[model samples]
Target: MDCILCGKCLEVCPLLRATGREELGPRAKADLSALLRGDAVALDAEDVARLAGLCLGCRRCREKCPQGVDVPALVAGLRAEHPDFRAWLWKTWLKRARELWPSSGMAAKLIPEKFQPERLAPFLKALSLLRGGPHVRPFVAVEALPDLRGETVLLFSGCTARYVRKEWRRAAEKLLEAMNAGLHKDKFECCGMGLESAGFGPDAARMREKNIRAWRRAGKPRVVTLCVSCHKGLADYADGFEDAAEAGEWAEALTPISALLLDGRYMLTENAPARVGYHRPCHATGNDLDHALLASVLGERLPTPDGRECCGFGGIMQLGAPELCSQVNERCWQSLAGSETVITGCSACAAQLTATAPEGVRVGHWLEMFDL
Candidate 1:
C-alpha cells in the first residue's frame, strides 16, 4: 500500500521543521519510497544518495505513522543501494573510533578551515566535540545506592563514553560500585547504528555480531548502557539472533543505567543550576526513564514542558548536509529557552548540543550531573 501522506510525520520531523522543506520530511520520504519501488522516478545513484541523506534517523516518523512504516529503515535501504565516500569515511571513523577519536579534536583544531573541503567540514565539527566541553559543576549527589542484586554487570559504553567522554564511563562504574555491583568491561565496537545509518549494512552486521559475541563471552551478564543510543542499538540486536530464547535473553539483559536509578534515591547539590534543562534524544522512548529520574531528583529545576526537544544530531546527515544539521541544532537550542545547562542521555545529542550551544550555555551527559 502507498503512503497515505497523512502528514503526521511532518509534524514531528526536526529536519522538516528546521529547514521548512517538505521534501526532507518523512511523508515525502515515504512517497519517494513508493515512487522508487514503482520505477516512477529515475534518480541516479548520487541523487538517491542525496535523497537518503535528508533523514535524521530519529525514528519519530515510525512512531507516528498510521501504517507503522519505518521511514528511517526505508531510507537506510535506499542508502545501501548507493554506497559513496561518506559511507566509507563513517565506516572507518566508527570502526576505528578508539584509535581515531581521542586525537580527532586535536586534528580538527590543527587544520585550517580554508584548507578543509565542504565534504570534510562536518567531520571536523564532529571532531571538535571530541575535544570536550567546558566543565559544568555537578548538581546531583547519590545519597544512597539502589538495591540491585545480580551477577557482575557489563558496561556497554558507546564510542563517546569509551573515548570522547571517558568521564561518563567512570561515573557509571562509580554508581555500579556504590551499589556493590561488580563491573565488567569488554572491547565492544560501535553500536552499528552509525554504520547502518550511513548505508554500510555488512559492517553494521559485523559490529552487532561482535558485540553479541562479547556479551556471550562475558557469560551474558546484565548489560548496562551509558548512552541512550547504545541501549537502543544493543537492544536491537535481538532481531538478529537465530534462537528465540537467546534473543529474549539478549533483550532482557540490556538495561539503560537511568532505568536502574528509578528506585534509587538522590539529592540535588548546592551547585545545581537554577535553570537546568533536559534534551530528549530522537532515539529515546516516549516515556524516558532518564528524564523521569531527573525530574524526580530535580523537581522544579528540570522543567517538563520544553525538555522534549530533539538535539538534531542526524547520524550521517552530519556529513551529507551539515548546514541542515546546524539549522536543526539551532532550532533545538532555541526550544530549550534560557537554560543555564542542558543534559542529555545520548552521546550523539550531547556532542551535537555541546558543539552548537550558544556562548555561556553548558552541555553534558546526564551522568555528569552526579558527583560520582
Candidate 2:
C-alpha cells in the first residue's frame, strides 16, 4: 500500500477541515474501509455505520490522492456492511416513482411560492427544480440545423433533471430541436448513483446493466446529459468499471450540454446579460473545457471564483452528518452570498446553495442562463 500516510488529504478534505476530526479524513477512513472490508477489523453494524457516515462521498480527496485509490468505492464496500436506515425506501421505492414524473404535470405540486427557499423543501428549492415552481426557464429554440443522417444523440435525463429539475429536461430538449439532430429517449432506469452511494452494489449493477441495454436499444446513440455525475457514471459503466476517461466514445458521448452547444451542436438564443456570479462545483476541476466555455459565455457577467469552496451536498452526508455538512457549506455560502442569482453547473451544489441562500437570492443551474 503506497498510501504514504502523509495526510495530504486532511489538508484538502472539506469534511475534515470542517469537523477537525482525523478519522473523518480520506486517508484514515479509506484505511478503515480496507480493514472492514478485509474483515481484519471486527466492527459491528453501528460501528460500520458510524465510519461510513463520516464520508461525504465528495471524492475531492480522491482527486488529490497520490496512490490514485478510489476511496468512495472502498467506502461503499464497507457501507454494505451496515447500510443507512430506510436506504431501500428512499433510494429505490420512492426515488424510482419520482423518476417517472419527469414529463408529468404532477411535478407542479412541489413548487414553492415566489421561489422562496423557506417556502420549499430542501429537495425542491433550486430554480425550476420542481418545474412546478415559478421561474422555469422558458425554452428558446435555436435555428434548426439541416437533417444530417445519423446525427442523433439520445438524452440521458438523470433523475436530478428527470424528477426534480424539470427545466433541465425542457432546456435540453430546446437544444436538441435547435441542432435539428435526431433526439430520442428510451426506457432508461436510474444511473445507479443512489444505489451505489447507498452501498447496494448488486442493485446498482443491475440498474447499470439495464441502462446499458436501453442505450443499446436506442441504437447506441451518443448520449448527452445535463448532469456531470450522470456523464461520469455512464462513462464508468461503458468502461466496465475502468477509468471512464479512458473508456473511449461511449464515455465521451456523455458530454455536458454547455460543451456540446459551444462545439456548435446547438445554437443558443441570445443572452440577456445580467450580473450573475458563477460557482465552480468541486467536480468542475475535471472538466476544464466546460469551465472555459462557461466563462466565455458569461464573459463580462462572470466574476472570479475566489473563496469558492464545496457546497457540502456530499451524497449521504446531508442526512448522516448535517452539522458537519453545514460547517462545510457555510464557507461556500459566504462566497455566493452577494449575487442575486448565483449560477452553477452542479445540481447538488445548486440544491445546497438554494437551501442556504437568503431570501430574494436564487441559485440556478448554469444551463438555465442560456434560457436556463
RMSD of each: 2.5, 5.6
In model 1, which runs have C-alpha deviations exceeding 4 angstroms?
105-123, 305-308
Query: What C-alpha lDDT do the candidate models reach, one value each?
Result: 0.80, 0.65
lDDT of 2 at 251: 65
Candidate 2 overall Cα lDDT vs. reference?
Answer: 0.65
lDDT of 1 by residue, 308-369 (tens): 35677788787778888888888888888789998888888887788777889888888888
Which candidate achieves the best TM-score against the true structure?
1
Tens digit of per-residue lDDT, candidate 2, span 133-183 = 323242233333334345888888777677667677887787677667688
Model 2 ranges with Cα > 4 A deviation: 34-42, 93-150, 238-247, 263-274, 306-308
